[model samples]
Target: MDTSTMIFIAVGLIAVIAGLYIYFYNKDKKTLPEAPAAPGSQELAHSKQLRLQAYERLVILAERIALPNLISRSNEPGLDKRSMQQLLTQTIRQEFDYNLSQQIYVSNEAWEAIRNLKEQNIHIINQIASILPEDISGVELNKKVIEFIMNQPQGSMHTMVQEALSYEARKLMA
Candidate 1:
C-alpha cells in the first residue's frame, strides 16, 4: 500500500478506539442526583409563601388608599377653596409617602407606575385649584375636585388604586 493509504488506515483505527472508549466510560454511569424530592420543591414552596404574603399586603394597601374616604371628607361645608385644595393635595402626598418604602419590595415597573400615579393625583389637585374662582369656598372647590377626579381618564379611581396595590404586591413578592 502507498504511504497515504497506510496513514488513512491508522487515522481510522484511532477514531474507532476513541469512540469505543467513550461508549464504555458512560455505559455504567450513575444517572441521578441524591435527593429526597425534586430539586425545586422547596424553592417552589418558599415562592408560594411569599406570594401569599404579597396578596395580604395588596389587600391592606387597597383598603388604606381607597379614594372614597377622601371624597367623603370633602363633602363637608364651610372650608375655603385654597385650604381645601391644599388639604386634598396633602392627603394624597401623605398617603403616597407613607408607602414609598414599599417600593423596595415590589417590582421596579410596578413601583414606578404607582409613584407616577401619586404624582398625578397631586397634579390633579393643583389643576383643580387653578380652575376654581377666587371667591369659591372650600366646599365648592372640593366639589370641583371631586368632579375632576371623576372625569379623569376613564373615570378610573379604581385603576390607579389597583395599580398602587399591585406595586405593593410586587414588592412583597420580591
Candidate 2:
C-alpha cells in the first residue's frame, strides 16, 4: 500500500486500541465508590470480631460444663446424691442457656457440638446418680462423675467441642 494509506490504517488501529482501553478503565471506575467500600470493610471486620467472640464464649461454656469441672464447682459439703445431681444438671443448663445467644454468630455445627456436650454431661450426671444409693453424699456423686469421665476411652466431649470452636475461630482469622 501507499504511505498515506498505511499511515491512515495505523492511526485507525491506534485510535481503536486507545478507545477500548479508556472504555474498560472508565467502566471499572464506575463501579462501587471507594468511600462505600470503607464502610463495608468496617462492617465485615466488625462481623468477624463478633464471630470470634462467640467462639470464645462457646469454648468457655464447654469448659464450664465439662463433667469434672462442673462436679467440682457445684460440689457441696453436706448435700445428698439427688441434690448434687440436681445442682450439677442445673448448673450445666444455666451455662448452656447463658450462651445460647452466641449460636447466631457461630456455625451450626459448632453450636450443635456445644448443645450435644451440654446434653451429654447432664445425661451422664443423671445416669451416674441414679446408679448410686439415694442416701449417698454429694461428695460421692462428685466422685462417681469424676470416675466416669476418667474411664472414658475416647476422652471427654468437652475437649472436642473446644477444639472445634478453636478451629472455627482460627479459620475466621485466616
Candidate 3:
C-alpha cells in the first residue's frame, strides 16, 4: 500500500485506541460501588462538574477550529493567501492556548486528540497556502481550503474529536 494509506490506517488505529481508553476509563469508574456520603463527597461532586465543564469547552473549541466554521468566521476580503494562512493558524493556536488548563480535567487521550486536530488544521492551511500563487486573495485561500477539505476523506477529524468529547462528558455525567 502507499505510504499515505499506511499513515491513514495508523491514525485510525490511534483514534480507536483513544476511544477504547476513554470507554474503559469510564467503565472502571462506573463499576465502583457507591458508598455512604462522606465529607469528601461534595468535593468529588464539584470536581466532576469541573471536568464536565472542561469537556463542554473542548467541544466548543473543536467546533470553532473546524475548517469550514473557521473559514466562514474569519473571512476577510483584502488579505493575501499567506496572511490568511497565518491568521487561521494563529487563531487556532490562541484558542488551544487559552484552554490549556482544561487539559488537567480531561483524559490524556482527549487532550491529544484536541492537540492533533489543532496541528492538523494548521498544517492543512499552510500546505494549501504554500501551493497557491503568491498573489491569491484571502477569499480565494478560504475557498481553496474549503474545497480541499471537501475532497479529503479524513478532513472532518474535528467532528470525531467532538463526538469523543461529548461521549466522555456524558460518561462523566453518569
Candidate 4:
C-alpha cells in the first residue's frame, strides 16, 4: 500500500479506539448507583413513639417496686419475716423481667439506672430481713423496710429510676 494510505488507516484505528473508550467511560459513570434516601417522617415518628412508651412503662415499674407500695401490696397478716422478704423480692424480680424488653428502646444510661435501682431495692429488703429474727412478724418487717427507705440519702431507688426515665422522655420530646 502507499505510505499516505497506510498513515491514514493508522489514524482511523486510533480514532475508533478513542471513541470506544470515551463511550464506555461515560456509560459507566451514568450507571453508578445513587445514595439511599433518608428515613421518612412516619418511620421517625413511630420510633419516637415506641421510645416514649418504653420510658413510661419503666417509670411505672419503678413505682410498683417502691418499698412502701410493694410492702402495702404484698403484706399479709400472720406471715413471718422470711416469707415476707421472699414475697417482696419475687415481686420485684417479676416486675423487672416483664419490662426487660423496654431496655432496647431506652438509652444505655437510663437502662443501667433502672437495673441498679432494682438491685438496690432487693438489697435493702434482704439486708433488713437478715437482721431481723426468723420469728419476726410481717408487720415488723414492713416497718423496718420503710424505715430503711426513709434513711436512704436519695429517699428511694424508685425516685431515681423515675427521674432517669423522665429525662430520656424529655429528650425525645425535645
Candidate no. 3 TM-score: 0.79
Q: Clash pairs of candidate 1?
A: 80-138, 81-138, 105-171, 106-170, 106-171
- Ordered list by lDDT, greatest first: 3, 2, 4, 1
- Per-residue CA lDDT of model 3 for 39-125, tens digit only, reads 768888898889999999999999999999999989988998888888999999998999999999998878988998887788778
Q: Write the per-residue lDDT of candidate 2 for residues 1-174, one digit (tens) a residue.
A: 234643443454345334434543554465433323355587888988999999999999999998888877887899988888889999999999899899999978678778877876776677667667888899998987787667555566687668767877886786
Candidate 3 Cα misplacement greater than 4 A, ranges: 1-40
Q: Which stretches of candidate 2 lie over 4 Å from their true place?
A: 1-40
Best of the candidates, lDDT: 3
For TM-score, candidate 1 versus 2, the one ahead is 2
Which candidate would rank higher by TM-score, 2 or 4? 2
User: What digit string (tens of lDDT, one per residue) describes model 4 on residues 1-174?
Assistant: 234643443454344334434543554365435335466777777888999999999999989988899999998988888888889999999999999999999877677767866876787677667767888898898998786556544345567557657865885786
Error of 2 at 103 (Å): 0.5
- Weakest 10 consecutive residues, lDDT, candidate 4? 1-10
Worst 10 residues of 2 by lDDT: 28-37
| Local accuracy of candidate 1 as per-residue lDDT tens digits, 112-172 | 4455455555655666567567778877766665664554434444354464455445544
lDDT per prediction?
Answer: 0.55, 0.75, 0.80, 0.74
